[model samples]
Target: MFRFLTAWIRSLSIRRIPMKIIVIGATGRVGSTVVSKLAARPDIEVYAGARHPEKVPAADNVTPFHIDLHDTKDDIKESLPEAGKLIFTAGSGGKDLLQVDLNGAVKIMKAAEEKGILRFVMLSSKGSLTPDLFSGKNPSPLANYLIAKYYADEWLMNNTHLQYTILQPTALVDKPGSGKVSLGNYTTNETSIENVAEVLIGLAEHNSSVGEIIEMSTGNEPIPEAINHLS
Candidate 1:
């Protein structure tokens, strides 16, 4: 397994990687973080999709557009335009998880497939795990959130076509990103959004991430260097 992993990493030495990203829910928590990371990298160009397109933050190489997942098919297409890949960082309204989390995601997937984009990354909660860490004890007091995440994960997994990576992140802390992380089927207590962004960046360049579900949390390690250990 180690040999196979190392060989896989070594094979990714190709020059000129294309990175045109369409970041859905870019104004949201994880979406914003992803946008910030891409802004700092010269190799990436990000399209920020938001409900209030004009409100999307202004940053280097970032383009904001109005895109409500509930909008009409033509409306969604108009906002998405051309992009190489997509990231879903949006949240479901209240406990209507199936409405947005499941259906919204499916709609987006179909749209991307029609537009010829193959890579997709999603930001979800760690609560989605089957033997949930907090299952025995009600952690958030709102179990439905986790329930929604579970369905979202299943939908992506059971579906076909796009190469997808599901990221189930730990507690979202308010620290400036250090870019280090710890990988586990379940996380401890908390982590910063910055560190999560670092992982998203790693996935952008990682082909092995296809069909994989990774859980992350803040660790003693630095954020930027966390993914280096993945190799």
Candidate 2:
């Protein structure tokens, strides 16, 4: 009876542990930050999904998993069964923008839906909803980026039942985060990548940030308060 009771207690404790959150594109600037921040939380575990798993940080709560955007959805899903929340921070790296940013993103969303994981957060750019926002020359890099983002953002909203938050920051800067931001209509032209990472993690766990496409930048309001206003 004592051994049986001890086994039952152990099972209960294991069941109480929170699910892991996977950060896709974990080698990137923003994605690495997400892995680090989420790893610091005692309640959360992080899987750093990167094209080269060796490049990911070595943290006890963070596990490196290899995931190429070109890989099949079944392969990606099989590699990340423990992931309950999926955050997409992958960029085209100046090559295969259509495949990586659009098609791959859509495939990931479908995998999430099939797996019954409802939480997803995408790191997107501002002006993704408007082609006219580009003022530069034809065949612009920025224009191409926006076009890919536009389709992915649209697909997530139109198809998936996932609790999704798409953050469209005007421009990303490498400066330290202020932990304050303005959500809905960009009030500032640039935002720190650190702040964007924080907001992504916040959206993964917080109920207030769900179901919103926030145009974010550094601002007066605190991150939590700004996200709350969105819902």
Backbone clashes, each candidate: 6, 0
Per-residue CA lDDT of candidate 1, range 1-231, in tens?
999988877878744465788888887777888887788877888888888878677887888888777866555765686987788888765555766776677777777777777888878777675646436765555467777777667767776578888887877887887555776544457878877777876776677668878778776666445555544
TM-scores, one per candidate: 0.81, 0.87
Worst 10 residues of 2 by lDDT: 132-141
lDDT of 2: 0.85
Let me know the TM-score candidate 2 reaches against the reference structure. 0.87
Q: Clashes in model 2: which pairs? A: none
Q: Which residue segments of model 2 deviate by more than 4 Å?
A: 1-16, 134-141
Best by TM-score: 2
What Cα-based lDDT does every candidate model obtain?
0.75, 0.85
